[model samples]
Target: MIFPPDLVIFDCDGVLVDSEPLTNVVIRDNLAQHGLDLSIDRIVDLFVGGTIMGVQESALEMGADLPEDWVDNIYSEIFEVLADRVEAVPGIIGVLDALDAAGVAYAVGSNGPHRKMEITLSRTGLLERLQGRIFSREDVANPKPAPDVYLKAAREAGVAPSRCVVIEDSVSGARAGKAAGMVCFGFVAETDPARLEPICDSLFADMTALPKLMGLPQ
Candidate 1:
């Protein structure tokens, strides 16, 4: 049996909370007014596991005139929508309870900035539970698809990279965790199993499988 990790790192969106579709909806509605009409699938393909700055850069490259405060505006709209609809990922609290019972430390490490993390985590009633344990891409020079953020999360959690296990919902996040030298578990709650097969050590949708996969008592 595999040993449990010293630290369990969770990606915030899609994994910790069902906020992707909600956030993307806000993006779609607002961007349509900007004349950058695009499908929700296209938005997810481009922005999942990407930082707000990266999103801005892409718009610039595509010749869209994004205002200096456009990303902030998007975040404001997302948070407004999230207040009424966001909820924690199914079974996530139970998994966290199991991890707590197993005596394993855990933290959130996300490609999103701290403000977005704050807004979503709070709206889902997870902020108090995860208050001081959050880590964001805004804290590092390199975000997802780079080892920096994950490595920093492990360090902050007081664990070695190899002793950390990352739960990710996006391809970039899985790559980031693996590059940090940690084992990665891909959550297919929103992603395709086939696309995740090569990168994830284990692919699962239900959060209840996580404790068992990590060798924690179920």
Candidate 2:
């Protein structure tokens, strides 16, 4: 974060809100119901860094002929659960405030669909800060690990990819940021720090530390 960022891009789920654990738990349980029986740790390692399509493809590889309504079903269940469990990531408001005080622009870039973002970010009280500013996988041809979403986000923000600083919670997102030429900082509070060590320019588990990395006064 020593570099002054022209734009700051946040990946919504784990980076901006504490939804990953809840989401992952649901995923694990749902897969178990599908007769997959994978542990939560295994689920995180296998799916944390990929798109829903990738997840579905992995399911297919696992011998699951997922019903066409499978993804929608999971989404419905996740939203219902999240309504009661969702919360912003600890210390993120301070980071957002610091960025605002420094006059830095930031936006959310996620692999989630619009409705998911609407439900989660809204419930977490982040919608007003980012409503129209959010970008999703539905906006691009390819999701994370492909650089499509990150590149489009940077382009729309009118900043060079090199001048943007991306905050990511997964290896796929870190790779996408790097692929888009942005420096990515990995948030490893809930995920194994080692997973993103190779791609993230820096790794941090606390949200309050981010503004300092962005060269903002702490």
Please report the candidate that would top lDDT against the real structure: 2
TM-score against truth, every candidate: 0.94, 0.96
lDDT against the true structure, per candidate, is 0.86, 0.87
| Model 1 deviation from the true structure expressed as Cα RMSD, one decimal place | 1.5
Question: Compared with the true structure, what per-residue lDDT tens digits does model 1 show for residues 88-168?
Answer: 999999998998898999999998878777878887788988888898887888888998888988888788999999999
Among these predicted structures, which one has the highest TM-score?
Answer: 2
Evaluate model 1: give its TM-score. Answer: 0.94
Flag regions of model 1 displaced more than 4 Å.
Answer: none
| Model 2 residue 146 CA deviation in Å | 1.0
Worst 10 residues of 2 by lDDT: 48-57
Q: Residue 67's C-alpha lDDT in candidate 1?
A: 83
Q: Model 2 misses residue 47 by how many Å?
A: 0.8
lDDT of 2 by residue, 1-218 (tens): 34679789999989887888888898888877776878888888888867666777798789765788888888888888888889999999998899899888899899988888888888889899886789999999998888888888889989888889999989889999999989999998887889889999999998988988888866
Q: In candidate 2, list every pair of residues with a backbone clash.
A: 1-213
TM-score of 2: 0.96
Against the hidden true structure, what lDDT does model 2 obtain? 0.87
